[model samples]
Target: MTACDQARELQRIIDQQLISTMFQPIVDCQKGTVLGYEVLSRGPSDSPLHGAPALFQAGEQCKQVISLEQACLLEAGQSCIRHGVSHLVFVNVSPGLLLPKAFAEDRLQSLLATNGLKPENVVIELSERYPADNPEALKARLTALKKRGFRIAIDDLGTGYSGLKLWSEIQPDFVKIDRHFIRDVDRDLVKKEFVRSVINLCERLGCRLIAEGVETVAELTLLRSMGIHLIQGFLLGRPNPFPTAELSALDNPDPIGGGQATSDAGYLGRYIVPLAPTASLGEAWQVLQSSPSIFALPVVDNDRPLGLLHKWRVMEVFSSTYGRALNETKPVSSLTAYDALVVEHDESLEAVSQSLLEDDLHYLKQHFIVTRNGHYIGLGSTRSLLRMMTRSRVEQARHANPLTQLPGNVLIQQEAVHRLQQNNPFTCIYFDIDHFKPFNDLLGYSKGDEVILSLARQLCTVFNGDSEWVGHIGGDDFVVFSDRLEIRKRCEEVQQLFALEAATRYPEAIRQAGFITGEDRDGLPRQFPLVALSAGIVVADSRAFGSAADLAATAAVAKSKAKKAVSGIQIVSNIAALNEMSDDHKTTLLA
Candidate 1:
């Protein structure tokens, strides 16, 4: 069709309000919950302008792009209201719609208000495909929109040079990585690295990332490991007129890959909120004003935190003679509190707090800067640091088993409960030494304790990570938990290693015979098989169980079966029937 024909058709469609809106969920991959939905526009199903690309292309051609954009915005708003969507609704806005002539700054706010929505509930997603002639002016307009409470997102990131430039300039609250890079990301290490870098960059900028066009579980799982929690695409949920979150996509939980949790359970990223190194003191002042309770702000350039800006220091300067005029326009780095502590996100909170307490940098202790990969994220307060340190010490002392120096059942239960509440899928393995009592009786309690310590050391070697946990439930009974896909394989490896150690720990006679002479419980002489490890594993499904007690119960039943099998792994899952390990028991080294 000619531009004239297309324009006429577009006009007719607009006058009749023939556009349709669909929603696709952007899920929180970590929590297995819906974060929000991105509003997608479609023309009449049978029309030539059906898809957003075609519809908007025709609008651009007919010089009616602004009109089409407005229609989409209104339709999206109404649809969200009709569906009673309380979560954030992401709406696509053309740069043309931001023009002084075509754009009304309050248009969206008014439309959302009519639909019982607020500006905060809407995220304006602008594609880089359309470049504005004056980037600075466009940013200014977006800044105005931000002040009015709307969140901005750069859509299809990495698809255009302008997008990258816009990202650096605007520092959007969210960035949607284009599907091209996300496609088959799991299989492509380069893509994974690229995405990982973006995830890290987002963290530094304090921006949340949404991986768009995720089409496979592999891609989804890979993104989750990289700390990209917000996700979108067909793999998560297809866009539909009446959309619902496809939480089932999160059933396959993968191990979180950052690193081990430090003492005091704190990381620097949790405490950092950074300002650009070039940002003026006035800008820093505004930041402090907005977050009235914040004490300090980190000044950073390219992910590297240069120094901190304390609220009191800023106030002191502004209150001084001509101080406001002297510093308001100067770079935040000029007046930053260099004495404030700077620490990496992975650093032990305990060590950081100790360092701070020893320094005596300031009389009024407040907050410290936190960095991940050298980029500033936010500030951590002294109060939080002290509280976390005290809690960690108390919990460690109270829950550690004195015998093995490992966490006791209480810690294990607490860990299980926390994972359950997060709906994080994992495997729980209950391990008990087969014929342990006979060996303990033969060797005596002190020797038995030595064997137990050896086992504990073996466990520590296998499950030494933040995502994996090990606990001594007492005596020969132990529990292991992991949210990794390789949990089963890891369990088998542990068993093999344990079997070898078990054979070695016994006397030469017992090793050669593969059995030891011991008196049965009734005081009858009998030959007992050499010690072996039995593991009963309960795999958590996507949906959490009733409680940690439910998980323990399930694991207990599986353990019974495993023990009956003599020396092998037994697996059960809440979502499926009981599953037993393959008949191929490891090498039959013992019994």
Candidate 2:
């Protein structure tokens, strides 16, 4: 369409309120819950300005950005209420509109009232794309909005013309890192460091940071590891007019970083009274003075954590010449250590440990903030984390197989029981060597050890993943637990690879003949086939098994059947099938 035509269309959209608002979920990855929705406005579907870029471009051309934003705000609030969305609603506002004279406070209040929304429920998101001509006036107007209970956020933080200056002056309640920094963040060191710096800045400023435009699970996993829980992206959900308030039930619902197991670290947390970020250093000193044992105080704003304020740092500042007079009334946020480690209470101990080790050494002696769903819960010391980890490692080592270093029977049962409780479908594969006693006689015990190690390596190689586990069940038997549907194909690969490995252990004559002569248990000489793999697979979902013991017993039964089969592989959907089958019945074979 022509520029004039687009301008006319934009005018009509604003005048008639023809804007359609789509809600994109902003999820709290740690809690697996929706924190809120970001309202995305689009022009009418049939118009040339249907997409946001074209729509907003036309508004800029027509010099009606303020008017367009007002319409969008009103439409967003009404749509949110209509959809029964009571969660926090984030609405985008132009920086130009934040000027005191450009936008009226009563108009905003009236808009919220008409839509049944309170000031605290709405977050006015200002994009830094267009720098404010008069920042002092904009700050004054934003202060007024803050006084009225409305929260402020800076959108597309790094992509704007005015970057740190805007953040420093505004001290927004939330800051959204632009998508450029978030894309490929898992693989990009520079991007990771940049985001880490942004996180630190937000913590020091007592602002909540959000990562935008995350499209891959890798990106999500990495961001979660770095202490960013609030996520917005297509990976979670796309924008829709009627978006679901919650995420769909996933087999692996939580985004765990570093392939760490899910375990709550809440027990290590100690509740401490947090100081407001706006509180003065003098106020903090008094509190630190009263609590002699407390080393640091968390700086919080509206229940959201900013960072930790250490006592030594405060004393050093106060002890400086003329420090008391110059810095007594300054906000505690200025002295807060933004780099203090913050972890969700549900984070795995291993994941938290990895994060701690990766941080600077100074953090080793510092207290880390522990939060539940991004809200401050308490503080956890490094000493406590290390102590717990030491205990956990000792227990894990006790249950690990000595030779293969895989989980022993106790851990295997624990893993199976954990999967069963989650109610997610998983597969268990039982593997045993065929004619192993005869092979052991033909080859010395030393050679037999090599064969066993080969199989263990193959199983580990095949089943290595975040949701896959390998266990040594003693002797020549091994078991694998996997959530993958293609696990049978992997089992076949292991069988093929083991066949090659088995040939290496045999003499040339025996390898060529594909058989070895050895004394049987009765002392009679018999010819046994070359050592081969026998695998039995059980795919479990909601079947009623009494315990992990019963599951293992069923897998053992399947392995017995597989030993008699020509293809050397057997699969059953559940234990009922095996129980119903007679001794003469042939087991199900994988195609």
Question: Which numbered prediction scores highest in lDDT against the true structure?
Answer: 2
Candidate 1 at residue 251, lDDT? 73
Candidate 1 TM-score versus the reference: 0.45
TM-score of each: 0.45, 0.51
After aligning candidate 1 to the native by TM-score, how far in Å is the CA of 188 from where it should be?
1.3
Tens digits of per-residue lDDT for model 1 on 297-378? 8777787777788889899999999999988999887788777777665566656777787778456456777655565655
- lDDT comparing candidate 1 with the true structure: 0.76
Q: What's every prediction's RMSD, in angstroms?
A: 12.9, 15.1
Worst 10 residues of 1 by lDDT: 582-591
| Model 2, C-alpha of 50: deviation from truth (Å) | 1.5
How large an RMSD does model 1 have?
12.9
- Model 2: lDDT equals 0.80
- Stretches of candidate 2 off by over 4 Å are 100-102, 245-591
